[model samples]
Target: MTDRFYSVIYTLSGFAIAPMLVLAQSPVILTGVVEDESGAAVAGAKIALVQQISSQTEETTSGETGSFRFEDLSPGNYLLKAEASGFDPYEEVLTIRSQETKPFTIKLKVGSVKAQVTVTLDDEDEVSTSESNTSSMRISNDLLGALPTDAEDVVPLLDRFIFPGARSAEGTAILVDGVEVAEMDMPSAAISRIRINRNPYSAAYQSPGTGRVEVSTKRGHRSHYEGSLAIYARNSLFDARNAFAKSTPDSDRRLVQAKFGGPLPGRRSSFNVAAERLMNNESAVVNALTLSGPFTMNVPTHERRYRTFTRVQWWPTELHTLYATYDFKDKSRENDKLGGFNLPEQGIRTSEFGHRATLRDTVLFSRNVRNELFFTFQKEEQRSGSPATAPAILVKEAFTGGPSQSFGREKKETFDLADTLTRARGRHSFVFGGRFR
Candidate 1:
């Protein structure tokens, strides 16, 4: 009976310690340090581990020192991934062995992230960590396809949201490739990006960036050619008539845009061209009372616009570059401001044309010093006149008008010269710029 009791006690003890033996045999750990290419620690990096066999995923973030550890992992093939802001993602296949500790060092490269001081290491082995304090929103080419930018009238939709504080277009500043412009005349396909509210405090701008829109154009490829054509059309096929109109007003709108870019024979020079044509027509309901009787009619309004942009980029040397661009626009409209209480005879016709030419030169003096010079010339002429010579008359809310007051003529010519120099030292950047118009 004593021998039987000893055997039973030994079996019970073995059973209770079996789980601890099993757990102690599978001690696997993974450790890593996340760093940038400059050897600076990348804090708050996301680290993920996936087991190949069990398909289990484990996620953790790096500590302030950029160190991460995963303890008590099962021995298997795993996919290790690390990612951080402003840096490219990292991935590696790790084979973990039982009762082993594996250590790794992950070095991430800089990506397309924009910063005030980019990838500059000082003599003290310190990296530039200060970033822009302003908030900015960017719309790339992928998003521009869905926006209502095919028509001139619809372009204001973005202004209403982007520059809500601006009272008018003149109050908001527009920049194209670091150069101030009165308008964006290039085709949508040629546009690469549109950024709002970027660098509000820089002295390079005449006004703050809080009410600014910056446009960047697509660059020409050195090895291949690219082109795109876009056509947008609309018509009043299924429409409801206005409550005051007898039938649905005839409406039609069409837009065609084409863009092409290619490198020159030497590949050191490139050119890009874009052209657009727009035609729009709409019927305006005229409800008015005249000396003869109540007059009601549908007046057709017509608008036509043509715009073209051409740019040539030449690289004289590895450190020096030049850009020349020309833009032209022509517009005509019939029956302007002739709706509602205004009669057909009160319609106004408008015609306008504009030309813009710009030249830019860039020189890189050193790794942290740069200079840029810009010259631009713009000319515009516009005129508006009523179709009828008769003067307009008003009857205090009652419809009475022989001619509209939308007649004006203006011509403007502007020349601008600007220069800027930038120098980055340690964690500070100094910019000196001046503009003359």
Candidate 2:
């Protein structure tokens, strides 16, 4: 990173787009063909994810061919649900691994329609939680909005969502959908629900747990959507209790964001859409006297960020389903500093911006085998140069270093692509994947 390095700006188009970039799962997927009574492949069933350990829940619909798939789902204790027009829905509990796609063939017994089915999976039975400290906590739908935030900043970002004063939670990995949610541009508020797994994972899963956090977003469900508009701002409400509390002048800040989404109708497909804009501005203060008389300098900081998403699903046949998604985003920040003296004083300003898009599809050839193909494109551009300063007729100022003149901008681009395949049998499940630059 450099002062002149220009990064592409992420811009959100009109309409509500999922703020899901930060939590989107990989397009790669695993399909669980579901069948109902009479050994008939049931279609139009509903499947929901129950976090075995935390008992949190998220829902998606099953496709035709008595089958349903878990797409972009992270590793956790997950189960399945099978539904029919005039029959009782069936629920099954199973474990889903990271980067691994496993298939299940489930048969449901005929039951009265009036009966309510409930399934529970306890992860503690398999993964020991006997000797772990600093537990991980997940906040979902209700809690997400209920909790307070500073200008709707990124979740777990800038060390937020962490215990106060706690240093870095290293060994921490956040999985969104199925891909790692490591990008800083992702919005934490977009997460519909989260699951936190701690250390001491089971031997069956020879994986060590860090401050491991798994997140899921709104996807593949009928009539599911969310939208919100907010205005957040703060002015110098100094209530410093401690002495020598790095005192400073009072300042004000403000931000606004809106989002909404729902399920796409398909026998084996899922869909979602969301959009948001976060605008922030803060005032800086300084009291002093320049070469002239008494005066005060006040500088305002401005930051703008926006995100959008539009996706659809096509399950033309049982063996093949198409998932198409498009996303666009733009973010920018600017800082303006002024002098305390004459109203017209020389000042410096800086700003930055990022962009990304992706498309992918998954195919289930047989009960135990699957293939995934997808590609993502990204670019960044930035512009930073000091604007011409207004003339100061007061005392002449001399150069401290090189002559103060205009500076040019620098830009950079990045490309990423990947493909994966998976197969599952009785006790052994295997997955292989490769990526292109």
Candidate 3:
């Protein structure tokens, strides 16, 4: 019995040890050199190893030789930023292969942070109040608290990607704790801080003209539980109308939202969760072909979205920390067909449900080579219903025992997983990995 018991313990321990052995066998490294355009060493420069869409930065200072090195980073794409107080920020993009060390190099230049004349517009005073066009927009917490929305939706406002028109039309990317946001379609549940790279002067970003947008979410926690809500709207009573009692142009506005998140267990290794909801409704009348004749069709719509997330952070050793994150989201919409009594018809109505889940396991193999693996899944279901025709009024035409009611439903699901290893050597960071779908 004693021998059998020992054997069982041994088997379990071996199971845990096997993954580490597999991981130990693979250690990739990245090396790089940083110099000035004048071919001069720029010592004291700060070199930051930043992940794809996150604010977490691992930094190293240049040696007296103007050289920098980072070791043991998990395999993944990384953005390198080299900055000096008196010099323009120098950034470059690089990819690292798992268990593979490669050499990378960069050349810095001296330049002023002069106003970009290429921006084409003068807006030093522009506060960026407009946010109705993009899928995501960022706003100050104070501003978010000040605004109002009918649905009490807050994700759209909190995650709003606010910036000069520096984002690409396809949209910038976002991340939370080194995880890719755009690749994950950025579920609102895991968002914290956001930084948009609209025309980023840094070469580290892959998108042309620095068109990508990146974001980060607050993980674990420094504070306890905290949440807030926002709502905004404007009606005819608040607008100036003409003597005809007709609403003047620009007399329509509506919005509402709310967001709440905080620490589950505040610390280096803890847990936390956040959630947000939002909704909007608005109406307007345009006078193009007719004098307030409503040439433009009148349309009405209702929309809603919800997001939730949970995360765990663990660190048993100074060189290692484990993090796991999961999130889910649901969105739906319906509209009232706009037109005239000429051929009045019921507006279209549709509803769609979607969800996503992800699990990431990260272990610090070394200061330069971090080992991480991620699993993800997504699902979306769309079911649309159209107006049931009046069974055509055929002459003598009323057919008895006409068509009966028909009903249906549809759904789809997708799954994906990724494993990676990274190591930073010298000025180069290498990310070697693979993904499955």
Candidate 4:
């Protein structure tokens, strides 16, 4: 029995040590340099190496020094390939051994000529390559899809991305597709990306870009139809009672957003449309001490908002394109400020309606020259009223009475036009534009 026990322990220990021995095996290192037929270093050359047995591939690009390295490779046969623009492809097979370091030299010859063309417009195709002086945060569609659609406002979602104390007293500047707007008029589903520019000081905008938020809307697909609908809802039945409320006040919020995009009837033309509806009804707990004694109640409040946006794109010629967009918004709120120490009579009702229209044209004059022109018109109307006409009354740390002090009507109209020209020469790019509002 003792001999059998010792034999079993030895077998079990060997099983444990076998894996460690395998894991301790040394890795292979493959390093190489790419060069042209003239023996000149070929920078930015693409390098691909594949393990024949595993069919696994690894890729890298040659640096300015024309050197590349791949580490931790297993011992195997590999197919090596290198490619670069204006150069012929190079291929070879390499056999690597464990714990071995191997070096290779690859040479590429000039390839046949190929025709390629690309069109770029002012601001629309601007690409940034430097990250020294600017920082930006982007919120893509995938991130937006994870957020609650029933959210009452976008500010709460945006606050986290802005730099500390970056917003000015006047608030951040909002630009939708290079056009400044008073507010976002499209649903979240219609937004392609939301970007925050932390170091915007360019002259293109009316305000500095330091606290600017740029929003780009999705474009219609020219070939296929795409559509989506999202609905969000929450009721009081699933919510816990508020600490100050007498009971679980009846409250509910519902939101619906739908968007569709597809090709239009004409060639090279497309259209995108989106709409949203939100209805929110909630109760606010009020705990106050009045002349009659303690006054406690739940004040019911409601809000409704509607928004619609439509965009059309048409290509009159191969080098010229036109875009038009229209947006409408309507919102109303009842008992806006009737909670806390203020009584229901002090509640305020407010309504707002707005319409915005825009037209843009982009023309490519040459391979290196482009021009863009755009115009926008907007009209906004607002009205608010109070239930009681008396002046407001307040007792420190106690109660408040009388009507809300906010009551007014206002109307405003805006007209904006801008034109820009861009020219690129070699590595340098020049841009010129002016705005009228």
lDDT of 3 by residue, 257-338 (tens): 3444454443446566666565544432322233234344334556566666666666555555555666666665554332
Which regions of candidate 1 fall more than 4 Å away from where they truly are?
Answer: 1-134, 149-154, 166-169, 386-388
Candidate 1 per-residue C-alpha lDDT over 1-437 given as tens digits, one digit per residue, 9 for 90 to 100: 99999999999999999987896676687898999988988899999999988889999999999999998788778999998988888899988876566578989989886568443312111111112434557677788777765483324655755646542447556778778887776666667777766335555566644466777776677678989888888898877768888888889999898999999989988888888898999888988777778778889999999988888888877677788888888999999888778888777889989999989888878888878888999999999984456667876555758777677889999999988887889977787888889
Candidate 2 residues lying further than 4 Å off, grouped into runs, are: 1-137, 155-176, 180-182, 187-189, 195-215, 223-254, 263-271, 287-296, 316-321, 336-348, 365-368, 383-410, 425-428
TM-score of each: 0.68, 0.49, 0.47, 0.72
Give residue 340's error in model 3 in angstroms: 9.6
Clashes in model 4: which pairs?
none
Candidate with maximal lDDT: 4
- The C-alpha RMSD in Å for every predicted model, in order, reads 12.3, 30.3, 27.6, 15.5
Question: What C-alpha lDDT, on a 0 to 100 scale, does residue 219 get in candidate 2?
Answer: 50
Q: Write one digit per residue (lDDT tens) for candidate 4, span 305-336.
A: 99988888888877888889888999999888
Winner on lDDT between 2 and 4 is 4
Q: Where does model 4 exceed 4 Å of error?
A: 1-115, 120-133, 148-152, 426-428
The deviation in Å at residue 95 for candidate 2 is 54
- Output the lDDT of residue 428, model 3: 62
Task: Supply candidate 3's per-residue lDDT for 208.
Answer: 39
Candidate lDDT scores, in order, read: 0.78, 0.53, 0.54, 0.81
